[model samples]
Target: MATLIVTLSRLNARRHATAPVAQGSQCRTETIPMPASGDLVANGEEIVELLADADCWVAIGADPDSSLATDGTGTARKLKADVPYTFGIQDGEKVAVEAA
Candidate 1:
């Protein structure tokens, strides 16, 4: 099975609460922030497209306090070394960005 991990570029406060509902059982709930309009990424293709087009790239596992920009303007962050991930590329895939 394929697992998808989503992270928001912006920072928001989230809350997790747990309370006892019955004599022994407990209830737990978490509140997360929702992305604004046109900011939701559905699949890998969409994420790839967004990264390809983004002038500013901010990933979850990037360098601390660093910004990566497509243009020759900003410093891009790097993914941390602890997390493991896999990237797939298929034939007939086109590269959209060009060298400056």
Candidate 2:
């Protein structure tokens, strides 16, 4: 069986706040900087590394403070904000957003 490392960042329910990732006996927390991407910014390269060995699930809650750009226009300024976005990753599957 593979291991899954879940890290919490500003993208979680609490803006700029993070939670601990506790699994079995391992306990560690790190403050991740929001990314240049959209709302769920922290779900970046590091998260991908964690799920590399297993089918993974990212359980992010909604974030109201997100300054997401309007639609595909990308008109809104890329505000320095954080939001929550969750996704599941299966090994060998293309890692990207899926249609709702």
lDDT of each: 0.25, 0.27
For candidate 2, write residues 53-83 as lDDT tens digits: 3232222222212233346532222211133
Residue pairs with backbone atoms closer than 3 Å in model 1 (clashes): 61-79, 62-78, 63-78, 67-75, 67-76, 68-76
Model 1 spans with C-alpha error above 4 angstroms: 1-4, 9-72, 81-100
In angstroms, give how far residue 5 of model 2 lies from its true place.
Answer: 0.9
User: Which candidate leads the pack in lDDT?
Assistant: 2
Q: Give the least accurate 10-residue stretch of model 1, judged by summed lDDT.
A: 20-29
Error of 2 at 86 (Å): 7.4
lDDT of 2 at 28: 26
Superposed Cα deviation of residue 93, candidate 1 (Å): 26
TM-score between candidate 1 and the true structure: 0.18
Q: How close is candidate 2 to the true structure, as a TM-score?
A: 0.19
